[model samples]
Target chain A: MSGTDKILLVDDEADFVSALSERIAHRGLAVDVADNGLKALDLAGQNAYDAVILDLAMPEMDGIETLKRLLDLNPDLQVILLTGRATLQQGVEAMKLGAMDVLEKPARLDLLLDKIRKAQANRVLLVEKRNEEKIRKIVDNKAW
Target chain B: MPWSPDPRWRDSDLAFFGAVTAGATHELNNVFSIIEQTAGLLEDWCADPEADVPAGCDKILNVTERIARQVQRGTELVRRLNGFAHSADEPCCNQEMNDLLENLLALMERFAAQRRVRLVFEPAGAPVTLTTRPFILEQAVFLAVSAALAGTAAQGIVTVQLTGGGAGVEITITGAPALPEAELPAAVGAWLGPPLWNLEGRVRTAARAGKYAIVLTIPKISEEVP
Candidate 1:
C-alpha cells in the first residue's frame, strides 16, 4: 500500500468509512483506515500519508484537534475535513485551523479524489520549495 | 401599515431558515460525494487501457452518464434552495403563491421525508400574486405544513391548495388533525396574525369534515403599503 497515492481515512462510522475506503481503494489509490482521531494521529506519526480524509465529529478527539496534531507532526500533510452538516461558522473555523478544505460527508468520490490529487501535488511543491530555500541558505553560508 | 415587526420572532425565523438550509446543503453534499466517487471509478478504469477497450469502455461510459444525471439533480436542488434564501431578502414584496409553495415545499421535503409525509401542492387557478412580507408568509406556511405533518398519521399526505378567495388568494393546507380555536396556541395565533394583517391578509385554522385546515387569505394590494 506504500505508493504515491497512499492516503489515511479517519471516521467513526464503521460502515460508511469502510465502504468509502473500499471504493477509494478500487480507484487504484492506496488507503489506510483509522476509526478515530487518536488512531489517525498515531498512524500519521508512524507512517507517511499524502492526505488524510478526516471526519469532523468524533468521540474523544474531534477533527479540528486531529487536524492540528497531524499538521504539527507533518506540516506538509493535506487534511480535508468531512462534515455531515456544514454551518457557515464551521467552515470558517476549519480554514482557520489549517485545514486544506472541508467537504460534506458522502461527498462525490470524484471530487474527493480530485482534492486528494491536488493535495499531493501541493505537498510536492511545498517540499521542493523548502529544499530550494535550504540549499540557498547553505550556499550563502559557504560563500561567507 | 398594519404589519408590525416583532424583534423576537426574527431570531426564530433566522433559526428556522438556518436549519432548513443546513439540511439541504448536507443532503447535497452526500449527493455530490456519491457522484464524485462514481466519476473516480470511471477514471480508474479509463487509466488502464490494457483491458478490452471496446467492451470495457462501453461499461465505463454508462457510469459516466450516470454521473452526469446526478449533476443535473444536484443543480436543481441548489437552484431551488437559492430561491428559498432570497425570499427573505425583501421585507415586503409581490410573490406568486404557487412559486412560494414550490420553493418552501422543496426546502421542507427532506424534513417531511423523515416523518414519511408527502407534501403536494394543487394550483386552484391561475398564478395568484400578492404584496406581502415574503419571509413572514413563508414562516406561516412552514408552521402550518409542519403542524399538519406532525398531526397526521404516518404515510399521510398534506395537500396545499392555492385558489382565489374573498379579497385575495386563499392558501389552504388540509389533511391534519383538527383543533378548535380554544385548542389553538395563543402564541401562534398572536404571532402569525400581524404579518398577514399587515399584508392585508388573514390566517384561520378551522375544522371541516373531520380534518383540520389552515386557511390563509391574502387580499391583493394594488399599491405598496410600506
Candidate 2:
C-alpha cells in the first residue's frame, strides 16, 4: 500500500473494465474503475491518482473532452488513452493535448503494464518537482 | 445508352459503408478486448497458489461465461455486417422491408450511440415484401433516419415505423426537433436526395411545435430508369 501505484480506469464496458482492473490489481497496483467520464472526473477530483487509463469512445463525454477537463483539473495528471483504433491524426491530437501515451485496445497486458509503470514514475517526478518549486518559493519569500 | 450512378451518390454510398464497417469492427475489438482480459484474469487466478481451489473455480467459470457472451456479441455483429455487405450484390432485388430495416438499425447503432440518441424501430406486423431497388430504398430510409437523428437532442428517441398499403410502403421517421424549422428541409434534402430519386420515392415532412416526422413512400415495383 505504501508504494503501490493508484490508477483510475475509465471505460464504459463493465466486463472489460472489471477484468482489466482485477488483473492490474493483481500486478501490485491499486485500480479504481469508472464507467463514464463524469464518474472518472469525480474520482479524480477526490483522489490523487498516479495515472488514468481512459477509453476514447464513451457515452455523454468522449475521451478527448475528458482529457481536456481532467487536465484542467490538474495539468500534471498522467493520462494514457486507449482506443479501438487510434488513427495517426488522433494520436497526434492526443499528444498535443498532453496525454502520456496512446494505446490501442486489446492492448497486451505486459505492454500496458509497462506504460502504467512509466506513467507512475513520471507522475512521481512531476510531484517532486512541484514540491521543490514550492520550497524554493517559500525560501525566497522568507523574512529570516 | 447505359445508366451510370451519380459519382457523388456513389461516393456517399461508399462513405456510408466504410463508416458502418469501421464502427462494427470497433465493436468487435471491444468484444475481443474483454475476452482477452477475462482470459488473463482467469490465468492469474489459477496461478495464485494460496487461492482456494473452489473459489478460484467459481471465478474461472464466471469469467468463462463473460467470454461466451462477448463471443456471441461479436458473432451477431459480424452476421449483420455480412448481410449489409451483401445488400449491394444487386442494384434491385426483392426484399422484406422489416428485415432490411432491422439490419440497418443494428448497423447504424454506432451512429446513434455517438449522438447519444435512441433508435426505435417499430416493424410492420405483416410482411411488407416488395420488388424494387432494395438497396436504394434502404439508403433512402437510412438518410431519413439520419435526418431524424440530427433533429433529435441527446437522450431523445428517433422512431422508425413501417406501414404497407395498396401499392407502396410508408416509412415514417419521427423525433423531437432539435434543429430549427427552416433548416430541416435543406438538411433532409441533402441526405435523402440521391436515394429518394433512385428509389422513386416521395418524402413528406410534418413539423409541429416539438415533434417532426419524415415519411418516405416507396412504390412496391419501381422501374429503373435509364
Q: Of the candidates shown, which would achieve the greatest TM-score relative to the real structure?
A: 2
Q: Name the lDDT value of residue B12 in candidate 2.
A: 85
**Model 2 agreement with the true structure over A84-122: per-residue lDDT tens digits:** 967789889999999999999889999998998888888
Worst 10 residues of 1 chain A by lDDT: A11-20
TM-score of chain A of each: 0.92, 0.95
RMSD of 2: 4.6
CA shift of B152, model 2, Å: 1.8
- Tens-place lDDT per residue, model 2, B1-226, is 0111123433487766776688899999999899999998877877988656565677677888999999999999999999988888888777888888999898888778877899999999988777677667767776677667666788999999999953788988888977786667656666677777877778888888888888888886645423
Once fitted onto the true fold, the runs of candidate 2 whose alpha carbons sit more than 4 angstroms away are A1-4, B1-11, B224-226
DockQ of each: 0.14, 0.72
Candidate 1: which stretches are off by over 4 Å? A1-83, A86-103, A106-144, B1-11, B48-54, B176-194, B197-200, B207-210, B221-226
Candidate 1 per-residue lDDT, tens place, A1-144, comes to: 122688999976554564578678876778999988789989998887778989876655767888889989988888998877656688788888788999877777778889998888887787788999999999999996
